[model samples]
Structure formats: structure tokens, C-alpha cells
Target chain A: MSPRQFDQRHPHPRPDDDSAPPPAGSGAQARDTEVDSLLEEIDDVLETNAESFVRGFVQKGGQ
Target chain B: MGVVTVRRVMGIETEYGLLGVGNPAANPMVMSAQLITAYANEGMPGSARARWDYQDEDPLRDARGFRLDRAEADPSLLTDDPQRPAPEGDLHRVTLRRRPGPQPEPATVANVILPNGARYYVDHAHPEYSSPEVTTPRDAVLWDRAGEQVLLRSSRLLAQIAGMPEIALYKNNTDGKGASYGTHENYLVERAVPFEDIVAALTPFLVTRPVICGAGRVGRGQRSEAGGYQLSQRADFIEAEVGLETTLRRPIINTRDEPHAESSRYRRLHVIVGDANQLEVSTYLKVGTTALLLWLLERRGLPMELAALRLADPVRAAQEVSHDLTLTRRLDLEDGRRMTALEIQRTYCEVLTEAVQHAAGGEAAAPDPAAEQTADVLARWADVLTRLGDDPASCAREVEWVAKLRVLEAMRRRDGLGWDAPRLAALDLQWSDLRPERSIYSRLVAADAVERLVSEDEVAAAVLHPPQDTRAYFRGEAVRRYPGAVAAASWDAIIFDIDGAPALQRVPMTDPLRGTRAHVGELLDAHPDPGTLLATLTARPPGPQT
Candidate 1:
């Protein structure tokens, strides 16, 4: 299948800037930033070492 | 007439479809990942208020049970959405990072809950929520039902894409015989207690859950030491050895001992023996009944009666339970109360009836009432057992066979194995240890891949649209693998087939044992089609081998 077709099926494309409004409160905003950072790190880790990360996770009972 | 103290304790986790392997076919994992991404993008909206039964702790509570709203509101981990969509309802967007290669259409859909205070993602593959703990069982039901609806809604987009296989969540541990599976559950224990008492009190109940929840399996003809035969809770023993050690090796009760709390006393009993029950009644009973049992064991301090009442040989008892279902074993308790299995069922009902009554009332009482269906199902299951308990010759093979088929199909259609790659990987996982000819199975997979590549054909298309009479083609191929399997010289005894190739010969199925290497070669020689072999061997759908 073409890349675009696969994307159409799963649709995890990067978030466009105007897609969602900011967090409700400043506290919520800060927490979202933290989550965003962690998500970024997770993406990096998954992209860099997909197989080993999965293997390690499984070995650790998928915790 | 008195102060009704309602304890608020509840938690929930929903394991979603995860797709690490990439396939275009609507694999649950692929579709789930995609949905999650979409939900995330849409800004997970927090429901206005928690469900009445969702027993989330007041974010205001402090160490001394005082309000903490002044100092700091406990930062919300999840966006609380009371009106989440049904499993078949609306869609949500989740975001996934772009990969380096030509990115396949966002291969994952996640419902984005960007810093929402209500519902949020728990893990990459699983979604979880800790409802405000509730005092009444009635309330817990709402949270459970709500969670189910949310999962169903979140899963709709993916399910539709993947041919909408009816999906279910298990609330028990393993398929009785040998396999270990998930039994998702939640509980509200005291926030101040020792882990020792927790393990001591819960271990026995956790270990023996299979007794009530185990779907019965046929006993392989080999007699046990107590002269009782055993079969796996799973239907086919062709790919798995049905035996006592097998059950013991992969235990139903797992204790990683990781308490998901800051303090030791607060531990949610995480159970995993659940089968994916199809019937709504079975699922309701699966969770509601087991939760009641745990509630009783934890609060009432019921000692492990089944273990003590256990037959001289467990394998025998297991076999008897599997075979006749009604043969009652007597369990003698510490209080000099000697009860047969039937009596225990009666007493269990009385206790649960009273317990629920007391909980319904504000009075402290001895024993707990049987949850709604536990008593009736136990009695009926026992009756079925008793009716057939005396007969050794009369076979209700058809009923048992149907039950086995139901279990088999339910297992095969789980959300996790929705994709071709993982489904195939799962078969490989199941057969890793039991392959008759390890090298030969591996070689066939390798050959299939090469053949497909050489033909420039896609395996998915191959499965959805086959080249010929699938069953006969597979059968012929399988027969070819066992050229010398059955020797004409030994018409009665099995002859060893060494070279794995097709042989047109019939072998008696009654042989007690056959040489392993030779059998493997012979079986492979039969040249059975991969599809048929997978279906018969794994009780699963055949998928692409990559």
C-alpha cells in the first residue's frame, strides 16, 4: 500500500498547529508540556531501538 | 437506622490493541494505535463529573484525611470523561511520531487527551483509570460498565477497519491446563496495611481461581497416578502436552509483587486467569463472581479450603472435575465444619447472600452472601457434573466438543492478534516448544516466504484469496511430509518416518508413544497446507509468516 493510504488507515500524522486548543489552566498546561516532552523521548527511543526496546519490555513482563 | 459508611475504592485498566508490526489489514493493534493517535489530537475532553460509582478520591484529601485543595490540587493524571463513547461509538484521534522511512498513513490512531484532567492514556498499549473508590458493589458496576463503553467506543474505528471481530475483555487468569493469560480486575484495600497479610490472605484464592473459572477440557487417555486422566483446559493437546507438570510450570497465580501505590498497605489485587468469555452472563459472572470471592477471602479470612480438601492426588481431582464435574470432595474447615463440595456451594451461597445483605445493611456479619450468579451457576455446573459423574462409558463428546470449539474461537479472535504478522508470530509463540520438527517447521516458513517473494505475490491476498481447494491441498502437502511414517511392516505398530516428505499411508492413532524425530519428519512429509496445519494445530487463524 502507498504511504498515504496507510496513513489514511491509521491516521497518526503529526498534529497540525491549530488542531487543539491549549490546556484549560496554567497547571494543566505545564503538565501537558511534561507529557509532551516524555512522549518525544519515547518516540526517540522507539525510533532508535525498536526491537531491543520491545525485547527489553517483554522480558520485564511488559511493565 | 444507623450511619451507612460507604467506602469509596475502585480502579480500572483497559488493555487496548497494540500493533508493533506493520500490516495494512485492519489488525487490532494497527487500528488501535491509529485510534489512540486520533483521540490525542482531538484534545481528550474531561467529562463534567465522575460517575456516582467511580470512587475517585477527593483530590482534596491530605495525609491526615484533611482537604489538600488549598495547598495543591492533586494534579490530574487522566481526563475524567463520564460520557465516553461506546465500543461501537464515536472516534478519537491519537498522535504518533513520524518514522524515517516512507511513513505509512499514520499507522496508529490514538485519542489525544492533552493534559486533560479526566481521562488519559495509561500505557502505550493499555489505557487505565483509577475511579474514585466506591463503597458499594453496585457503584463499581457503573465504573466497570463505563470503562467497557469507553473501550468499545475507542475501538470502533479500528474494529470496523479490521472486519469487526467481536472483541471481549477477560476478567480471569489462565486457561486452566497450562497457559497463563490476563484476568483484568480492580479492588479497594485498606490504605494502611502490611504486604505480608495481603500476600498470605490472597495467595490461595489467586492460585485456585481456575477451579471456579476453568473451562473444562477432555482428559487425554493416559491415566494419572490416582488413576484419573487429564486434558488441558484448552481443547487441542496436539500442539501442547496435557499433564500436571505443564499446569504447574505456567502457574495461574503470578506474584511480581509490584504494588502500584506509594505506601505498602494500598495494594490492588491484580488477577489474570480470565478467558475471553463470549456470553454476557459469563463475563458478568466472570468479574462479579471472582470479585466477590476475593472480597470474602480478604475480609472474612476464609482459609484455603479447596487445597486442604484436595484429593490425595490433585491430578486426579482435576481429572474428576474435568470429567464428571459433580463428584464432590469434602473440605474440613478449622471450625469443625465438614462440608462436601455441594455443601460448600450451599454455604458459599448463604455466606454471600448474608454478606451482601450486611453490606446492604450497616451490620457486621459472619460470612458473605453469594454474588448474584455464583450460587446458581455453581449448583447447575455441579448438577451437570453429578449427572455424568457415574458414567465412564457414556460420552457427551458433542456438548464438550462444542464447548471446546467456543473456547477455541474466542481465543483466536482476541484484539491483540488482529494483524497477519502478529497472528503468525502468535502461532510461532504457541508452537515454539511443541513443534514436532522444529527445523522442518522453520524451513517451511522460510520456503513459503521465498516462494511468495519469487512469485511477487502478497501473502494477505494469498490468504483472502487462495489458489485451490485449501483443505485438500494442505492435506496432500502434509501427507507428503511423512513418507516413511507408517511402515507396512508394522501394520499394528507405528513405523518411524525419518525423512520429512509426503507418504500415502495410514497410521493407527492408538499408539501409546512414537519416536519424536521420526514423527516430526513423518508429519512434515505429509505436506499439509499451512492453513490447515495452523487451524488444526493452533486453534487459530493462519496468517502471513513474516
Candidate 2:
């Protein structure tokens, strides 16, 4: 199935610029932009002390 | 034609992973209780006092037609009794004693039956949300998402309390340490279908189900000591093919026989092998396909191919399937044949597809919602298995493991880091964080990187109202309308202590299909007071009361 048909069946989040579809063959570039922005966002809010944070996350066993 | 569909009584229970922002040493028991209390007391008023009625719960009774002796049972198996944190100076003493003054009263609200027909309570050290029963998988995903909103609200309210440490909840199964909690799914099955039949027919399906719905893990072993990723978070933790114990020797098919319904007719299949999924599509298919499989077993006896497709060692195969990211590892069968996990899943899917068509008798019936949904699940199941076989990356929109792997791979490629990087492990944990600002999955949802099966409004509405098709409607409505008189409630009964009644009024809802909105909505609306409602219900004719 085409991406549009799949999106129609299972709804995807509408992009910010929904007024017009991107020009041909821009799908790869659009995905790269999305990944880059996500990484940039993660860099700001990710926990600073990664090693200690990972080590200290101890949980009691549960069912 | 016999009804062959995914419509069955199914529900999900999630045990959230909680962490104190700065106080890593805080007692999880106390913190979990505080989270429940915060939600009940401040988030939803008048729900704080409705205690859970555990009279019908018999956790030791096994579906294998026997009961383990209480002396031999694990302490975690004794779940009927009210669980209180150990008292002061005990072995498990409360560690939230940082203040110089006298110790404050422990958070007393351990359990509350919500207006949404859910049980928000503390199960051991983690806050558990047991959703109300829903008959369809789409509703299953909606209500499960509602449970997440419950946790998010509880966290926000608890953080506002004076001197209360900020708590973050994760919709995940493991802590990347050895300790693993559960995100269990329950399906109502006919008791006439012997337990052994279920065990035999369901083992291979459960062993290979992770290819579609696994919430990816960053490390190999349960302790995260190994330096690799896997498809499932709970695969390494599974040690048994079938057993009664859940905390130790975790089983693929848990034999807990607590139906919480008419014991003679229904047996609630307690499934503990699944990960707590975040994507809506993952949760939808996880429940939908399983329900369809159970329908197939109940209607038509196990297909010949399914009967012959038993794994040689299901426990080992479960882990092998998870670890094989290439999606091409062959698993050995008991019949001396080998097949990849994808092939096994495809066999089940194809069997059900043919069964559904045969049941229809090549005649087009009028459009039925249940049959349509079953067809939808079958189509999606086939689509997912086919896509996974082609390229696992193509399934990022609908598969939880694939979606998570994409984000992790993106980060690794950008930073030139290996699987052992602490940043990647931390990112894995934060992906499940409840806070939208901190969760990478939430960021993906916002970026339209994921697909959604339901809308935000549907989830929000489910948070306030229970599904109108099950006995949960009566339970949720009674709690919502007459909060002052609902003394306690369980799966099959509700106890009301009206002011002038000689004794407590007990109403037994033995049938899960009855007591729905169609049965008692008007009765509930007619009587604003619990006393009159009880009187009217008792005064009705004694023949087949709705």
C-alpha cells in the first residue's frame, strides 16, 4: 500500500505544513529533518548525569 | 455462521515504573501509595474512600484444576489481603523519614475504584492501573491510554504537595536492572476448553508474538549487563512455559484462575508475557490478534497445522526470537522441523483467515461490527508480518519495537556511539517517561513519526466514563452517582452501606455482559440516592433481574 493509503487507514499526525504536499522525491529529506529536530530536542532535556541516573534507577521486584 | 471475531471481554493491567526526581533512595512502596492517594484525593474527589472488595479474589486457585497450599505459596501470590507497608523498625521499614519531627501518617489510600471503572492501586512497590473490561481491542487501547493519563495526573498532583519529591512514571516492564514488573492482559475464555488445550495451542503463538508488539529493549540480559539490543523487554525474564507463580519463575501462560466472573462459565486467561506498549497500534494488535486466536480455538477446534506446530523449547525460542533482529532466525519445532518466527506467526494468521472465510460460508452477510473488526485485525496482522519479513524498519509506524529502534538507531548514528553507551540506555528509559516534555516517544508522536488508532478526545472521555457495554458501567456509575454509599466493590459484587439500612446491601453482578448501561442506566438515573436505588432493585420481581 502507498504511504497515503496507510495513513488514511491508520491516522498519522498532521504535519505542520499541511497546506501543500512536498515536491517529488522529498520524502527522505523530510524524514531527515524530522530526525534532526528530534535529536536537537532530546539534547536539551535529556538527563545530564546519564551514568548515575541509569545506575540509581533501582526498583523492587514486582509481579 | 458461528461468530468468529475479536470481540470478547478483554482488559489490560499496567504496573508503572516510578522514580523520584532527585531522591533515588526514596522508598518505592511509600511513593507508590502517595501517587495513588494523590490521584484519589486531589485529582478525583470522593473516590478516595471506595475500597476494593477482595472477597471474590482467590489468587492461589490454579486453572489446572488444583490449588497451591497457602503455606507453599509465595507472598506475592497472597494478593487478596490488604497490603500495607511494613511498620517502623521492620525489615522493610519506611525510608521516607528525612524530617527531624515525628513521622507523618503513611499514605492510607492504597486502593480506589475510579469513576471510569478502573482500579488504581498499589501492587507491591509499583502503582498499578487495572483497566475496566472492554469487549473490543480498539476500546482496550483507548482505556489503557486513559490509564496513562491517570498516572500523569497523579504525578502532577503529587509534585504540587509540599516537600513531596517529583515522581516520574514509566510505561515499561523492566528497570534495566534485574527487577521486572508486569503489564498483564486478561481475556475471558470458556472453561469447557481445557487448560491443557490452551497451553498447547497458545505456546508457539506467545513465543513468536514479540515480532509485532515487543517494546524494544536497549540491553540483552535482564540486568542490562550485555551490550546489545533486543526486540522484547520481558523475553529474557520469561523462564517457564506454564506455571502459577508470577513474581518468581515467571510463566508464558499464567495459570491464575481468578475469573472475577461466573466461575463455572468463564476462565480469565491471565497473560503476563507482554510488554507495556506505548504506541496505540501495538496495543490494539496485541490484544486484537490474541482475542481472534482464542475465538478460533473456541469455535473451531485447533487447526491441524497449529496442532502440529509446537516448539521444541518454547522458553529458549522466546529469547532467540527477541534477540534475532534480522527477523530470519529459524526455531526448532517438536516435530523435527524448523521455521522462523515470522513463518510461525504467518501460519496462525493464515489459519484464522481461512477459518473466518469458511465460517462465513462464501455468503456475504450484512456488515457486522464484530466481524468487521475481526477482519481488520486479521488484515493488519498479515500486513505487519509481511512488512517485518521484508524490512523491520518499514514497520516503524505500527510496531513499538521498530519505532523505538528507529529513534535509538538515529541517536547512535549521529553520535557514533555503541550499544553500551550510557546515553542510549538513559534514552531508552526516558522513552517511556510519562511527562510529554521528557519522553522521546511523546516527541515522536508530536512529530507525526507514529500512527494513532484513537483520538485524544476518546482517551480523555474514557478517563471519565467507563465503557457502556460491560458490568463496569454499573460499577462505575454507582461510584460516580452515589459516592457516599459505595462501601466497597469487586469484579462481581458491589457493597452499599446506606445510612438507614439494617445491614450492608450487596449486589452481585455475576454476568459480565449484564448490568450494562442498557440494563441499569435508567434505574441509576431515576434514583439519585443509594437507599432508594437499593430498595427499588431489591423490590423488583425475582425472575432474571437485569
Candidate 3:
């Protein structure tokens, strides 16, 4: 996923661009934007350190 | 009541394996009875014999068009008993104080809805722990872990009771005797979205998911060829793309069209394809990614490309993904394209990213909480896929199958045995055993070899408290405050005999987001008793039903 516009806390933050949308509620906007940056770090490690996701495991019978 | 909450009320029901008992001749039925009795006998504060209402259940009503046979519709028949009461009283306290005698066998399925808005019950001869409704994947992990804690504590307590050998629980699907239980997931989807659309979209995604989140298996073929290790334990068991029966003719997309939310507004997607993951990371990713895909399908109609993503034969693809650990197995897609499981999974991830970006790019896109969750899912999904694409062993910490494979591979090399060795199969069973000391997964978690998503503190907190954002808040509070008054409780409504009223009052929680902390906290506080609370709640206008 491409890095998007976010404040210091939220990395892939919600779209804060809409000042006041008629249909959407403001309850969701209140949460802290702290989950994305950590995901970015995990993203980096998984990209490099964590290797293949489906290797080393095989069926019990000869395939 | 937000823009995307119809997709947020999610929960998981896991049937745990009972081991460590039946030494000389430990009957599972007898052992299950003991474990169920242990919890019921040692009743917690919110414990009562609150009846489980089965009025809304209609499993036979397929998401497609026709109603299945009555036998197929009644999923609760597996655990239903009208006389069974909720676990109440201070049995745990009494058991601790006195010399525990032979525990009485429970007459019916011991269904105890915990204070944390989750249900702990014995179903189909297994102690099943169902997590409370949660808004996101992260909460799903925390609450799911809380269910594990429930199993662990109950198992430990059973060990203490005399005449009862220690009980062991495993968060796995299969019992290795060809009989498989389920790790069923329920997700709220817009009822407006066609059920056929859901099956078409989810079939391929569910089939390929084992490549990333599968709990590795040691043996092959549930009732067929049994020599090779498969990627997932549940794969060989799923025989069709869509079906109403979970026990017989288990399908990839379960048609248990029992929408726990309001029928007109929301439909519950009963996902049966997933494996019960031991790794917290795998659990998080499994739930998070699936929720995102569902949201994408619900908000925007199922894309044509997604339909094109379907496998030529879904059952074959599901099994192939498990058997082919090299990530090189190619599935014939609906578009006549043969794609590897890794490729198909990555494509889903890529589409998820594109969809999120597309939504964000919209002009009046509000600051949605789902955006934050979607971000979490996207990053984790990408990370796991990258690791899986690289050298599957590297993901040993986060991916459950990899971690178990590493343990088994090391043992096999040390013993100089083949994968088909019976000892290796035993080791595989030992890996999932929930006994803290004996469980290899527990050992891995202790040694910091497995990646954990939620903290133990979060799990503990969830065990005692319901989430503040869903109808679970009200269900939990009602049970907590009026254990004696609660006549029955179901997903969408609660039947309570408030103030000893002759007739039971039905409190309908049609909107999953309405009876939340923000919506009903003050109301709950104002009316300290069940009688007053029901009167006040009913008097209030039907506002914000969304």
C-alpha cells in the first residue's frame, strides 16, 4: 500500500480531508492515529527478515 | 451506526480439543461433561442459568434462494437443550474450599455467557469458546485469546477435581480420526449485498488463505490418502464451494443465513474455511484480511475481477493450497488462468490496497475508523505475504504452519525419520495441546519464538469486560446485573423476566452499534436494577437505529 497523507500519529490515517461530509459521522474520527507507523515497521521486517510464508511445510503423503 | 459498522460486528466460535484425560479409558463424553461441570459448578458473578434463545436461527435459509432441509438449518441442535441453565453460583469458590467430590454431569450443554460479552459452552462434546462481538481484527485477537484463557482456566480447574483426570484443549479443527470441528467466524455484512455475491467473492479468497494463515498439519487426507503434510488441517475436509451443513458436506462459504443482526439491515457471513490459529499474529491477519475483503465486497459491489478470481474447482484448490507448501501449486482460475496460491493471495492484498486508496481518494470520504483498521490489515497482509513469498521458514514466528513445520522438521532430522512416521504425527498433535507445559506452541510463545499481537493484559481485560462499542455491551451488562432475571439471551435480542414480571420482556438489539457504551452507558448507570433499566430503555425513542 502506498504511504498516504497523515498527521504525526497516523501513518495510513483516515481521510481527514473532508471537513464535514453530510452522510458520515464524526465518531470514527476521534480515535488516536497510532496503529499505522508500527504496521510500517512490521511491513519492513516482513519484507526482509520474515522469509517465505509457505515453505518448509508440505503434505504428509508424497506429492 | 456508522458508515461501515454493518461489517464490524464480528465474532469467532472455536471448538477446542480435550486431551490429557481418558488415560485408562477416558470417554470424551464423560471428560467433556467433567470440564463443563467444572465451570458450571464454580459459577462466576454473571453466571446464571440464562437460556440461549434459538428463535432467530434459520441455517437452512441459504444465502442463495432455497431453504435447506430443516435438519440442515438447525446448527444449534448440536448443542441445544431447553433445560440447561447458565453457570452461576460460587462453585469455584466452594471447590477451592472443600475436598472436591465427584462432579455431577451436566444434563445439557453448559452455555455460560461471560461478563466479557462472550459465550463459554460445551457443544458437540467439545468445550467451545465463542468470543464477543468486536469491531476490528485487533479486538478479535484480544477476545479470541480471552476464550483461550477461559479454556485454559477451566482445564486447570478440572485437573484439580478428584476422580477427574486433567483436561487438555487444542485450538485445532481436526481430531485426527477424520472427524473435524470448526473455528467458525461470523462477520456482519450489509444485507442488501446479495448472498450469491458473497459466495462468489469469498470462495477464492477463502481457498487461498491457507497459504498465509494456515495452522500446519502433519498428516494428509481426512478419510483418504494419509501420507503427506498439508498446509491446512481443514482443507481436505471442505468438499464444496457453498453448502448449508457444516458437519456433513462442509463447504467453503457456509450458508448459515442466520444473520445475528437485524435481518433486513445486516447478514452474518458464517465463515467456516479458516483454521484455528495458535499464533496471535496469524489470528489477527486471518480475521483482519478477511474483514477487509468483505468490506470491499459490501461497500462497492463485487468487482468483475474478483469473480474472475474464482478457482476452476474450489474444493480442489482448497486442498491443493494445503498440500503444496512450496507455494508453487497453480490453481485454475475461472478466467482459465492457473495462478499459484501465493499469487492469488498477493493479488487479493494488492486489490485491498487499491480499494482502500480508491476510497480515500473519494471527495467526501469521512475520517473513518475502518481506514485505520484497513491500514493495519494491509500492512500485515503485505508483510506476511512477502515473508511467505521469500522463504516460508522466516515467517515461523508469525505464521503458525511455519512455526510448527520448523519444530517438526528439526525433530524429524534429529530422529532421521520421514514425514510419514507415526512419531512425527504424534508430535504434530502435541504441538496444539493447550496444556501450558506440554504444548509446543506454548513453549514457542514462552521462548518468544512466536509473534504476539495483543498483550496478556488486553486478554485479561477482555475476559472481565465487554467491548464498549457493540450490542455486546448491553447483553453483558444485562447478564451481569440480572443473572437471575435473564430468562434467555440471543445475538439480536435478550429475553428478561424483569421485576418478576409474569411475562418476559424482549429487548431487541436490532442495531449492533446502538446499545454500546456511548449509547447506553448512562442509561445502564441510571437504572441500577433490571426492572428500572428495561423500563427506561424501552421508553426511549427509536433513534439512531442504524
Best by lDDT: 2
DockQ of each: 0.01, 0.34, 0.02
Clash count (model 1, backbone only): 97
Off by over 4 Å in 2: A1-33, B46-48, B82-107, B362-367, B541-545
* Candidate 1 segments exceeding 4 Å error: A1-63, B1-8, B16-30, B42-141, B155-181, B191-251, B256-264, B276-280, B287-546
Writing each residue's lDDT as its tens digit, candidate 3 over B275-365 gives: 9988877887888888888888878888877778978899988988899978998899877899998888888889778887776674454
lDDT of each: 0.30, 0.84, 0.69
Candidate 2 accuracy as lDDT:
0.84
Q: Which candidate, 1 or 3, would have the higher TM-score against the true structure?
A: 3
- CAPRI band for model 1: incorrect
TM-score of chain A of each: 0.30, 0.52, 0.28
What lDDT score goes with residue A26 in model 3? 39
Off by over 4 Å in 3: A1-63, B1-7, B20-24, B71-109, B362-369, B541-546
Roughly what TM-score does model 1 have, to 2 decimal places? 0.37
Best to worst by DockQ, what's the order?
2, 3, 1
Tens digits of per-residue lDDT, candidate 1, B253-362, equal 32322222322354454443333322222233345545555555555555444323322322333333344343354444445554444344434445555554555564
Across A1-63, the per-residue lDDT of candidate 1 in tens digits comes to 111221131212222212453333443334334334333322232224323322221210111
